[model samples]
Target: MTTTLEQTAMPEAEADQVRAVLEYYWAKEWTDGLPVVPVTEGYLAEFLAEVDRDPDEVLFSITHLNRHLTVRLAAINAAMAGCRPEYFPVVVAAWEAIAKEPHPARGIWQSTTGTAPFLVVNGPIRGEIGLNSQGNIFGSGFRANATIGRAIRLALINVFGLHPHKLDQATQGTPAKYSACIAENEEQSPWAPLHTEYGFEPTDSVVTAYVIRSVMHIEARHTMDPEQLALDFVDTIRRTGSLIHEYTSALLVLVPEHAEVFAAAGWSKEDLRDFVFEHATRPRSELVAVGKDALSHKTRWRLSSDHPDSMPDTAAASDDPDTVRVLSHRSSIQIMVAGANNAGVSAVVEVFTLNPPREFPFSYSRIERAGH
Candidate 1:
């Protein structure tokens, strides 16, 4: 359940040895289709020293794979992913959150849907570690955002053996599968940070994980009207391809400009969620046209049997069958402000799993710094 690394200093390997190590990793498919940092005992020790927990401590386990991710292994992957020693806690916290997912952890990683673990970091640690929450936040130019996400992927491949075309059977994975991590632009936001909505303190450093199938950008620059912007978001969320399941949910990443628009209209995050929930609907005839009506029937059955008390009676009472709501509940829509204020750009991340467990899509864990 634990892996201990040798604490002795390791001299730098010669050029030949370094080349051999890289060759070995590539041949063994240990690398994520890219050259790794060539993790040495000395490099590993630096990362281990930054964590208070035992190196051998099992952060989480995938029972089906017979795999256990110990702190030492996590550090190894983190080091290989080019992470600084200080970044270890955030990486560890990410895996901790993934372990708490309601669905089988294996399914989340190995689903045919090509879903990836999307991480949203909040709290003071964003500044402490130089996470990019501003311009090109989702793209590149930030080490913490890039490697923290890569560390998780490396662990899944190296430790759990969820290698592509093998244990991990993804059908045309998105580029985000390589790295999908971002910090909330809490400073520019007009509302509370994401962690606070989960009852975490404003100062609590936290990482939230969601299984996302796709990250679609919504560009609505023409309007200052919040309702018009809401319509653009609604259209993206109600796209037929994204409606694979009736209980699907969405994480709307609003740019600061859009956030300001909502704030100016006296709209809270709740108001935005309510608006999306009420309007992001498709007529039953559309679902029938798209062959999703059977799935909708299944959703109705599940709602009636599993959550009769919380069923949408208003939608059910309507004589017209065209009143089908895409999201199962008002709580299904999550809004967070991120990206730059310059462009009228935002992103809508499609959640991978249906919400029968209701909390199927997300899990959160606090980041515990070493010295603090």
Candidate 2:
């Protein structure tokens, strides 16, 4: 995990050789439409040294694509993404978490929804590797966050062969495809860190991976009331374009200021989730209006007066077919605190729902540093 590369022999190359290397990667489509750092033996060795596992260890494999993401290949991509050697462990952890996903993740990369692998890093590793949890957490500037995420994307392109129009059939891709890694703003958060909610200790470094379709920014600066903020989030979640299926989930990235307002109002994350699940409804008629009525009934969570057992306490709420809840369960909504406290801005990342419904939609892997 150390940055020192004293053991590796990194020889300086001529200007022509550097240009040729860049051209070679571009021609081979190994890059993500950006200039990549040449993956030399020296750089690869430095990255590989940070991981304790075998270099040929298969972290994950896409059987259809006939590709296996080995530890050695991951290090090569991490180096090409301009990641520091110290950041290699986090990258490795991300792939491990992705590999644990219950759904066929290859579909997530190749689906027409244009979904991207959204990563959330928690615990001590955030500060250890200079990951940004504050101010422009999703934007450019932080090298660790940018490159670690980019490394995964590069592996998807080169190793999995998920190029734009070929295996990846994303109609219109999202900008998050470039890089979508962020650390939890634990210091500024009102609730426990995200990993803790999944039974991980606060002391342990962990990486959580989710396949997300798009990021919808929520602005509630005008309101200080927790209910009002919840209403705003409900509006964003219940939007027609945001609704991919009947049983949808979302990652609510709350800024410190907004989370503080909720905390002050004695609203926990569970309370917010309940509130969102109860209020984020759009009626089946609206879906019909949007030409989604046919697809709505295909889900197991579809509610109707005839199927009272579909949802809990069906008699208590409106039994009308129009009363369609956007989220399947209260547990579907995951709230995490991130971003600077400068604004009341927050984000709602729509999670990709698998057809069969994955037993575990999100996967977490503990970050293991070199030697340990």
Q: Give the TM-scores of the predictions, in the order they appear.
A: 0.89, 0.89
Provide the lDDT at 74 for model 1: 98
Candidate 1 per-residue lDDT, tens place, 154-258, comes to 988999988899988888887778899999999999999999998999999999988888989998999999899999999999887776665578999999999
Model 1: CA > 4 A from native: 1-17, 104-106, 296-320, 355-357
Residues 241-264, candidate 2, lDDT per residue (tens digit)?
765555678899999999999999
Q: 303 in model 2: Cα distance from truth in Å?
A: 15
RMSD (CA, Å), each prediction: 7.2, 5.7
